[model samples]
Target: MEQGLALLLALSLGLLQPGHGQPLHVEPPEPEVAMAVGASLQFTCSLACAGGAARVRWRGLDIGLGAVLSEAGSSVLSVHNASLSATGTRVCEGSCGDRRFQRTVKLLVYAFPDQLAVSPATLVPGRNQEVACTAHSVSPTDTLSFSLLLGNRELEGVQALGREEKEEDLQETEDLLFRVTQRWLLPPLGTPAPPTLHCQATMRLPGLELSHRRALPVLHSQTSLERPDPTSSEPPTTTSPQATPQQGSTGTPRTDSSTRTCRPEIHWSLEPVSWELLCEAACGPGMTVHWTLAPGGLAAYKRREAGAQAWLSLPPDGSRTEGFFQCRLDPGGQVVSLYVPIQKVIPKT
Candidate 1:
């Protein structure tokens, strides 16, 4: 009777713990993640213990739109041309014999740039100069904007030059062009030194960020001071001719600095052959004046190399012609006279 009672107690224990008699299975699916902006992505799920009749189920945490790639024993997902919204986690569940097993993985998406550029690289100072930002292979679906960065201030007035989109069989590319003309009044010639101008082009794409830049330099014309008569020894006091008289002994003192005479001297012949025979006052005695042939085939002074004396050489083309010639005078190393124009000199009749 005691043995019978013990056997009844053992059967009661087996009925109370049904799973303890067999192996327990738990399925936790591994999560898969990938980037979406520029490339494709894939997810893989692994299984632990396998049951003869086990089944796998796949799902996403926050992914808005996606289809299940495979739902058999194992899970595999492929995403083409992914985007930022595809970031999140995935879960897989396996079920068999009234037991549930699951696995999870985190997903991360990357954003691909549609346009790129540098900071302001060009500055335009004048009213007509142009500033430009150049970008290559930008996304055509995105809008591009451009502006100027002056110190800490942002300026607008830029114009889009052009846009282009092309697909090369497998991939597509785009370009953007922006330009602006300087219209503000340029500072006076003596205004504080102008600053460098800078420009930027920005692309407005939903999932991308990029920009380009250019800097240009400002420029202006400079005012020049009037020069005194070269023939007169004294520097010009003013631009007026009355201030520097061309007559009278004191009209314009011929300083001993230059070889030029304040008064006009005898008009020397300007003919090529005459120049060869006449002696130039500016050249050293015995120095040869080398004549250079210009494209017009005219005999001209190439340069006056310091030598014993100045001499003239006829052009090789025999096209040595005459119009006007400038001559100066020098006494030793000091200039005794200034340059003066000699009119035409033809062959003597």
Candidate 2:
């Protein structure tokens, strides 16, 4: 009986011995709750097993747009563009022989921000314009904080416009509206203009960090100056003409046409057969006007004065509508003119 007892103890000890310097495998970490829209979730799993070969498998069940970000010695599962329906069980399984480990993360997907846009107000120097920055998402209020970012500078805006709130009627049945706005002022126009303005919104939810940004080109008007003190009796000591400043360069002349040729533009309507507006597009110093057309969505196409080509094209919809038309000037009249509103109706259903 003593020998039998001793043998049993030896077998138990051998079986319980440490894994002899073998690598330790681990299950991936999973989120505790649901993920919000516009947020991302990543699951990491690793295999540290002794010897020749071990494998790790990661999968997210029923989550659309789910991806295997990495699959090697370690594995990662990531989900982007998540929606409410994206929530489900995520599983990470690691296996080596009879040794196995697994982890499960329950995911609940919430609504993401819907509309994102910049205010259409004209930004003037030293004037303030409220940029309407907002996000419509069903995620918990406390889980996300919208932010404004430009380059290395982070602006919550001049002042917090505060989140939009809706009030329900006593009957609890009525339409609801919510909006958030922030004000930003353009710096005084000068040489070497300031950087373009942009707004960004960031969504911080458990297991996810997602952000979106949009840029607005800073527009400024140039002021013209008369040749300094023309009335001065001074023979006008010869002064070199200042170099023409390029776009985004600080305070420079708006129009520099010293050597450029001035082409008389012909703006006429072909459908109505009448001249609506006469405008000239400066073509380099010697370049002449070649062709002009009422670009897409323009109501009428007009031929230029100097027998230049004239044509008109319909917008996406086949409706004869009157609206702004783009005029392409020439060598590559690269700088296209603004939309010229034309007066003509092709017809609409």
Candidate 3:
């Protein structure tokens, strides 16, 4: 009983001493901080104590380790080339007399996607073309979106692929890369005015939203041809064809000046004509009618003989045929036209 009373008296005396037992309060850095990769950051720990000497220290929650950043009354932690491994909760501890106190703050490090790009700088009109857009070096892969647009209109049936994750072992971080593709079937002449293609990328995250856009111009060629009048009464002049060597003839074949020439007439008509008979009469030896497109113009052709069951479709590679030719072209949506013409060449008399 005497020993127990002596211990109680000693504790009371210690408590009565001035500034022997004081409360310590610590204030950590901001509640949260965000920084990009390869950047620098600093965290501060503030302390308040009623008595006794006060000391401050910092520790990482993820690593469960403490390190001395500053030795004065306050503590400061500095990080360089901040990366994913540096992100987490950090604790600041302060001690005064026999009392200890701590506070915690969170750090977040992220990277935004790089700029967007378009493939095939130039786009040709009236052809099936593909445009590809790409973005690189993005973080937090899931918060990204990509799209293609023309002016304010969003293109339909576009193909998009992304989120190819890359790991960096040294930085202990992950990055993402993405791409989007669009297939366009341009009209023969495109729009009345040139169109612009736009590529966009968006990143959505808490407390932050980022977006980027890139534009490309579409180019096209235009052409027009004037049709000749067929009702004139004047006869065309005759020019002799180049003569080939004959077995018994010593001199080249010659044409008489009085011989009259019949020229092939071209016109745009709405009604279909007999192609087989027209071709047979117009395309004889040394006398033929040729078909061609105007400068900078593109067209597709379909043909039907006098007695054919179906119209034969011709490839886009400029083909020549003597027949009733039906040419079609598209300049833009809701605009299309067909030209049907027969070339008639008169045989040499």
Candidate 2, residues 1-349: lDDT per residue as tens digits? 9998976675565431223332433333434566655577666667766764657776776433447754555777777766555667776666565555566667766544544545421223454444455544334444445555545477433555456633323243122323333444433434454445556656666666676555543434321111212112111121123232222222311243695433233343334332233434544454434333232223333333442333333443433322223333355442222222334534222
lDDT of each: 0.38, 0.44, 0.45
Residues 181-295 of candidate 1: C-alpha lDDT, one tens digit per residue: 2222222222353454445556554344565555433322211113212122222222112121121112222233474422211122245333332223333244333222222
Write model 3 residue lDDT over 113-230, tens digit each, in one string.
4555554333445555555554556565566676777666776644444333444333444433223323343333345634556667677765567877766445332211222111
TM-score of model 2 relative to the true fold? 0.37
Worst 10-residue lDDT window for candidate 3 reads: 329-338
Worst lDDT run of 10 residues, candidate 2, spans: 223-232
Model 3 per-residue lDDT at 128: 50
- After superposition, candidate 3 runs with Cα above 4 Å error: 1-30, 61-68, 95-100, 113-115, 120-131, 149-194, 220-349
Q: How well does each candidate superpose onto the true structure, as a TM-score?
A: 0.29, 0.37, 0.42
Task: Kindly report which residue stretches of model 1 are placed more than 4 angstroms away from their true locations once superposed.
Answer: 1-40, 43-76, 79-124, 156-194, 217-349
Q: What is the lDDT of residue 287 in candidate 3?
A: 42
